[model samples]
Target: MAESGQDQTKYLKGPDQIIPSDVLKTWEPMGAVKLKMTKSGVDANPPISVPSLLRRAADKFPDVKALCVKRDGAWKSITYREYFAKVCTLAKAFIKLGLERFHGVCILGFNSPEWFISDLAAIFAGGFACGIYTTNSPEACEHCAISSRAQIFVVENQKQLDKVLEIRERLPDLKAIIQYIGKPTSAGVLSWDDVMALGEKEPEEQLDYRLSCIAANQCCTLIFTSGTTGPPKGVMLSHDNMTWTAHANSVNIDFALGKEVVISFLPLSHVAAQMSDMYMCMYSGVSVYFAQPDALKGSLAATMKEVRPTVLLSVPRVWEKIYEKLMEVGKSTKGMKKSVATWAKSIGSEICERRQKQDFGKPVLYPIANKILFKKIKKALGLDRCKIFISAAAPISNEILRYFHSINVPLTEIYGMSESCGPHTVGVETAFKIGSCGRTPPGFYTKLLDKDKDGNGEICMNGRHISMGYLHMEGETHEAIDDEGWLHTGDIGHLDLDNFLFITGRIKELIVTAGGENVAPVIIEETLKGELPCIGNCMLIGDRRKFLSALLTMKTDMDMDTGEPMGTLQPLALDWCKSVGSQAKTTRDILEGPDEKVMRAIQAGIDRTNSKAISNAQRIQKWQILPKDFSIPGGELGPTMKVKRSFVAEKYSDIIERLYDV
Candidate 1:
């Protein structure tokens, strides 16, 4: 067994070794010195560009498996050399197709090896790649393509091809559409093989020369924001921005070279997945296995079992679902099994608490508990080999975090945005705070703007990882990144004495009551969701209103935990429904009209949440359960499953107004 001390030491670097002396001196005046930065323990260095990293990885680990994807019911792989050759071939093809330096090529797809190849190909061709979410509507897709002025668009399948074709006439700059999976069905639509054939005809010297001339500051990708508040803006990330992120994350996360395995499941369009999985894999020579886009949820367990990945990175929702499943199984056990499970969890929680306090003293039963329970639980979750399990893209519930810790899964939360290349701060196993999102990473400096009484303010970041700016939106770019170089994140947070970051809420999402009280709705909403099993999403609505009200959405047909059909309410939810005098036979039945009993049950949940509120002003007075839950396909939720606040409020204005009508 690995000693806990040694395990922690492998990932944690001393604070003094992270920041360069000259850079520290430069930011000392602005109080940036107080913030924590990742320590590379090396001198200031220029990051290797994306293409260079790919070439180096191929040269270093030529025969090693670099990419894997499921094909025809089997997992197929490509070696580092083969992957590099494919990227080069696509790069040459793009150049042959008249793609000029700094021009844009848009890739619309789910996570796939081909997506990575195309992304790298564009960069290697001395052009930039724009990633559009697969869930984006036709108009949204067209907007991103037009905004980025992409010359070529790559679609995943027939559906995406149709969307692109629907807006084809609107996109005059779009020279061609490349379908990755299926045969070309229409004019102007090309097959993957066609592009490769084109590349085969082009001179290798031309492709190599183009790659060699690529500069660190040159734009490599245009990642569009989720646009929960407004139309999505294309964030222009340079080669320097991406490569620096890869290098910094590699050091910060202790990415083991050649030995680490990663399952690429999240949308590659998101910066988190792109940086952590694709770019980091390239930088560290980690083998990556691609998960099927459609089967991600159902096949995750099978994939995890097969891959046995050493590092796992995911959004909060994935962790929450895992926690729910574990709890469901624990609750289903009986008699001796139940008692043993309960006792094991108790021991695990106690050990976790002790470890958090740096108490290494071993209790008599510690070894026994690990042997009998904790190890088994880790193995069951397919995380026995995982050294680091990260949750990012959005804030996770502290309750979920504690529950995972109790079962021997220590989930670390990281914080960042597209503007900062997906990670600004990250909690390390050695020095993790329960609710804080660690400290700023190396090469970045963070500060707070418009601090409140408690020092909570808009989190601002200035760093090498920060993107150049939004593409073609000069005014918006100026507003986001100031002359001083700080990119205003618009996220409300505060730094602790140790410089650990605690994100509270978004500046735009804050709720203000007519009574002159400012409320951070996220805390209240999270509290309600944590307290109610049936609740899927909770939105606090009372901006300029007399008091706070809420719009609650219930979970759907399937049991959130077990994934079993809730033909009727599940046991716990059934009890609540009975208390409310609800005769609803199914989960859908209750959500349809939500009888008085259901309303009472929901009100009881609200009351419990109110009891935990800091002040009466923050308490939710009245709430109406919505008929359906917010979802990515519904345009009410972002790709990461975060609520699109503006869209939700505007879409349900009538329902929200009725809550406070009295």
Candidate 2:
């Protein structure tokens, strides 16, 4: 034992022996989520509040560029010190504006520095931060605001402000609205500058007190679900949930401190984007550049060329579009250019195949092909410095992955939901299988429950990164997380011999026919798209029905400005039409007045898909091509490009009825 005023470290055996008794006592558990702390787990996570993490970064890398925003054709950089100062000032402003503890500061905007500051400030002020999608309707925005009981709402521009104002009467808890972009047109609305000015008048004592009160186990943020099946549920994320996952991801991805760069474009409302763009970056001292608002609408490539991010996280649809555009451009190449490209692709494919089999040895001709072909392709796509390509939030087809690999770019798939803090299992470049979603990170555990004959079962995970619970929904929270503290992810998957998790389908999305045969629609739908080159989107339907049928949309040009599908077919679709000997130039031209050759070609593709079906009931007995492709604006797909099955079924009830009627 040490004397009262003596140094205690001299008596300790190791760092582990110096455990503070108050550390565990300080934990504040939420709902039914009890803290599960082990020496190793605590060592990995080191329970800390969000504000402390930001403070650590600021103290270590004060002069390092933390954020970059483009304005007047020039990039404006803000250092870590400046970022932290702004966050603290804004938090003081939030406290001055009467931000009640545990209430939300709802941010509705694209990915920007202001949005980032607002989110952190809310947590620092002892309030939870909630992100609202920019593409959400006024009603949808109101739903989120009400659910979170938002005290302050931050919008990007006048358009987003107008939405909140329209539903202002319904939002009783809303205390203020701040517009970050332009001058506010409405009365009582504060400009971004106004909020900063207000902070200058307030003292830091209140803010510091609030920050001290923050506990790692307390909910600091809310991630609203995309609501494909039903109403969106607010996912309550504790401070430890965000911080632990960020640290774990930093270790898993081998993030280089003060070196890695990334572009922020995906909706900040999403967990994947939030984790990568905000939490992960802050945790690893990575700098971030904000892309233009129209990044997803054809401007992403231009932004990519400018940023040249070290790591890129994109949805599968974006990857597919890039693949299609490259293939379309390749079709015009002739002579030696085309031959060298072909040779390079072959070499690239051979290397990728060997890499997948754990044989990373390069072929003899790889260097020659890489210099003449792969390097140029990577430079053109602005991925020259991109070391890691990640696909998440949706299932990416093996075709898309192979196509990327053929260009010397391999996409690694990450698997998780909002409930898991966006990353549970992640694919590493060295130890990854092409079709699998990699292995779980450190301090995380996964198990399959109620496995089928083939060993596929519902995937469940439990870890420090797991969410606290659903916000204010006790029944739903109990259903999602069992008494054993395992998050029962509705997603069905199987772990291979190497522990690579392969997602098969969702339990709710499974179609059980009247004859009692179960069918996973995703595999069937993917097979159809593989068979038909012209088909853009496919949805299989036969739930509680006699036989299976599919609804498909032909590949068509999308309006980059509006994100809507156009009547004209894409160049590849046209090439496909010509290959089948059809003269049709548009989907309407082929559908309104059916072409014999095109119909026969489609029939052939369907027959091929049917040949692979395990049972007659699993086969698509009929399919109808829609007039337009599925898009975000059309409400067929979510912001993450996930098809809303229930919404589609409700919208196309008559079309679905017609298929079964026959």
Candidate 3:
């Protein structure tokens, strides 16, 4: 023991330690769902929704910590008492603006307390909240605005308002644009203060009037998926459906609660980020920290050092970046550095194997490696005390998972669309399976319907989180939701004996080659993307042509000037991405000189991984590689960074036409 006057301090010397052992340790998987047996079985169907949660938590923990925002390079906190008052204020403002039961109000912005306040406000006013990606293209925004007939548009700043302004005239139902960050500078837009001005001056009585208007089954919000093939349609999520999964994932996992801290990074427009960032944090009375968009890394590191956050929510890309950086470090240093890296890779491989098998954290020989290498990695990312890492929005590579496991962090995979307001199948206290997305949460019924012996079929679910329906699209509503109340996810998946869900592909993205065999491009793309660090993402072409083909997007980590990885193993045939958005075709000619070795490696990874697939659809016979990664800012990926599949398919029509035309 130390002397009485001695100092005791904890250090974030390295990477975070998240125990996934409890979550995935049971070798038995349940095909689609494998929730651990609780004290009494979990309520398989829950009905209490999101607004009720807001109302309840507001009343119960009004004085508790709620939100912390980053401004001036530091954080400022807003207690739950303040949170409740603002939510009531915003809700009252919406009612005063002529919103009524079942009417539509849309919010387009990045992550913030304002987003949630607006949502609660809309729900309390007996209207639905529709959120559009703040990064959406003008056409995409117009389509959603018109279809939802959104009476109010809440925007974040000047850029978002610019987009809404470009096509504001086309959306006749558009009522007003409420700007949050600053005064509305755009013509025809209303400042947040102006809207607040519309609220009754008698604030206390106004809160009562707004609260009196809401009920249980009322439409809470309409979330739009950056749609694949058609106009963006709003998936109508009721308040109850919005809150069910939150409570379920919480109670079932015995979630770490109390005045804890959660770090919010991903765009809140997506559902997964909201589950952990907004819902879970509030329930636990945790202080939620919001990092600014531009200073994510610096702010994240600083915030974590300050907050020692319990949880971090993000998409696969961030994890992928971490892996790439670690690999770069391994490749960069010398002598002892090189030797330790080789040793670490070997040890890490073993760690991943044990992890995938759900028996990780076994006695290890890399105690020194943990002290020197892994700890450094954790400190840089500010994940020193991170309790759990929740990954969603895209399929994360097992390699990244293995990398994190080697360093001690474990990612809990959750599956859902914007329609659910978050997770349906999410990892709780249970350890994880390598490929499966984990078990469905309580209150949801999950099944792989119209599937074959392999259990591959449309992954469908009927749950408390099910959206009311697609707003204003009767045909799409009928198409998505069946009479039985199950939502046809249009995703093909299989269930193992233990109910762990392994999504095989998108049913809608299936390709039929000229040979008449159906192929799932995502299957091949995932396989290749898993191995090729240079490759950001790829799409398989030649759906009905002589042979399979593809267009590969290169990762931004590698330098365009030097074809090398700038760190790890570099790929073949890459440069198309660097030149695509260029004003000149002369610059676009860079793709003509792509590294053949990089191209072959991407092809090799695909062919080798597809050894299990039928030969006719296996290897990509011809390919075109890009020098740039698709991004939401680049008008490629959505705000959630999900591929706008049909948009990409349509945009590259001429290139795709030539591949199939041959």
Q: Which candidate is the best by TM-score?
A: 2
User: How well does each candidate superpose onto the true structure, as a TM-score?
Assistant: 0.90, 0.95, 0.83
The residue-by-residue lDDT of candidate 1 on 1-662, one tens digit each, is 22212222232221111212221111110111112223554215545578778888999889889999988989899999999999999999998887876677899888888899999999888777888888889999989888877788999999899999999999878887899998987987889999899898888887866765565554678889997768998787867678777888898888888889999988888899899888889888899998767534466877887878888988887887677678667767899978887787788787667766767565678787778777898888788898888899887888888888777777788999998889888887765778889887666788999998999999999877777677767688778887666889989999988788999988788888998888999988889988887676788998999999988766554543433333444444554465567767565687566476777777788899999988989998888777666666566778887888888889999988788777
How well does candidate 2 match the true structure in TM-score terms?
0.95
Over 4 Å off, model 1: 1-43, 360-362, 558-585, 591-597
Worst 10 residues of 3 by lDDT: 24-33
Instruction: Identify the superior model by TM-score, candidate 2 or candidate 3.
Output: 2
Over 4 Å off, model 2: 1-33, 41-44
Score each candidate by Cα lDDT: 0.78, 0.86, 0.65
Q: Residues 1-662, candidate 3: write the lDDT tens digits.
A: 22112231221111111111222111111001112223444443434445557767777778777887777766677778788777767777776666655566778887777787787677666566777776677888887777666778898898888888898778777666789888776677777777766663536564554444343344556667766666666766554555656776677556665646777777665666767777776666677877665433324555566777767777776676666656666555789777776676566566656765666475567676667766777777777777677778778777677667667666767788876667777764245676678887556679877888766888998765666566656577778877666778888888787677887888778888888877888778877776555567788876667788787775544343332232222222223322223221221333556544444555677667667665656667776665465665445666555677776777777777777663
Rank by TM-score (best first): 2, 1, 3
Clashing pairs in 1: 18-39, 38-441, 38-442, 580-597
If ranked by lDDT, best first, what sequence of candidates would result? 2, 1, 3
